[model samples]
Target: MNTLRLAALEALLLTDPLQKVDAVNALHLELPVGAEQSIQDPGGIPGRPSHLEFVLPQKVPRRSVHTLQGRAALVHSLAHIEFNAINLALDIIWRYPNLSDRFYGGWLTVAKEEALHFSLLQAHLSTLGFNYGDFPCHDGLWEMAERTKDNLLARLALVPRTLEARGLDACPVVREKFAQAGDQQAAQILDVILRDEVGHVALGNYWYRRLCREQERCDFDTYQQLAKQHRAPRLRGPFNRPARLEAGFTERELQALEEQA
Candidate 1:
């Protein structure tokens, strides 16, 4: 039977935030098993709207949310992250093969949630007189995705665990900023994103451990190796221990993360 997943992945990579979200929402997530093979990487990178100007992380300007323009800038940045996340999840579903059907199923859920997040944030941006691509953004997230493109293990270890996990630590701080700025709705949107992220990170944590177990590798050691090999960004914290714990990180992992700082 033909899987709907590849078709859905293709749809996700098309341009325009609203239409892309609609495509994802239209997916039949359950009752479909992924095809084991028969796909080629896209000839070009995933589609993006023409207005988005990608720059180095250092080059992206930061603004205070005390002003309306500044608040919109912050929301635009969040929308960019969600946009890249949707691509990441879609990429994982199609790029990796020879795993349990559960793997594909799980990533599909991640993709759907990410699409929802992008839609939510994008809509909020509109209320603030901005759109997803109104400001320039850095390509750090997708850069890691490209680095991990050839190895599923590296992808799992770095993209989700190393990169996405940082969101767990960052959300609360951002939420408070939004609230202090008197943007209760913006803060609540962050609440939803943070809640969904815990589960996504948990899925990554689960599969990373699963893959390491099946490969007869030590989980902690393998993660370190992957981080070094991929030159992953150093994790910073003031971590949200409660969220990390909810996201399936053990105390041992938490300790290791702390020691990394």
Candidate 2:
């Protein structure tokens, strides 16, 4: 397919609901078979939109989930988030242009991994007799993506490193909650996501630092200013130091982040 179509596909994937597995599957056919299949086998083609929309809607059920139904609802909520995350990665690749091919490759790899994560989570949700979108979810993650759309630097700094890295920080806590709830399978799934997300955050760091270097700026301080300017969420600590370090965060940078907290 042409580049425009590829980009449109990525956008559609972002808005499409997770319950339509066949529609998801067709997205694969829009690209070269091998490359598209590598993008997690979403089943449909994407169409173009003449305009963009932003709505701060909350759909996930807020009521307590004390029974089996509640557990399933929560699982589906998480699955929906992962589903959006997959498209976010793809959009980064298709929407932005003129970067090094490595940038495109990096995001494509991320998109595939995110798709895998979403599929795994969806399968687990199904076993509990709940599918994605069976419960309501917040639009917070995608909202951040929309906010960062115009500036790749801001996108790299905020979405992956800030918002997505927050996932890395909270994974352990979520795992503990799952264990407490005796959902060993869900806890194990979270473990896999945590391991992979470290790499994702690191990829964001890689690009952010690259941009800083290319532009001849101090990466750490710039990140600080961007966070404040964007009103991005303030980071909390008890950080996963090892994961952050592996994700290309320098010791000095980590110190700076801690100072901000």
lDDT of 2 by residue, 1-261 (tens): 344336435555544445333333444333432232223335532221213232344534554444688778767767766776776776676556567656766776676677778888889888988766565566677778777777889999999988888888788977787788889998999998988899899899989998999999899889988888788977888777888888888899788778878
- The pairs that clash in candidate 1 are none
TM-score of predicted structure 2: 0.79
> If scored against the real structure, what TM-score would every candidate get?
0.96, 0.79
Q: Report model 1's TM-score to 2 decimal places.
A: 0.96
Q: Give lDDT tens digits, candidate 1, residues 144-250.
A: 99899999999999999988999999999999999999999999999999999999999999999999999999998999899999999988778899989988888
Model 1 poorest ten-residue lDDT run: 29-38
After aligning candidate 1 to the native by TM-score, how far in Å is the CA of 193 from where it should be?
A: 0.8
Estimate the overall C-alpha local distance difference test score of candidate 1.
0.86
Cα error of candidate 1 at position 181, Å: 0.3
Q: Which stretches of candidate 2 lie over 4 Å from their true place?
A: 4-66
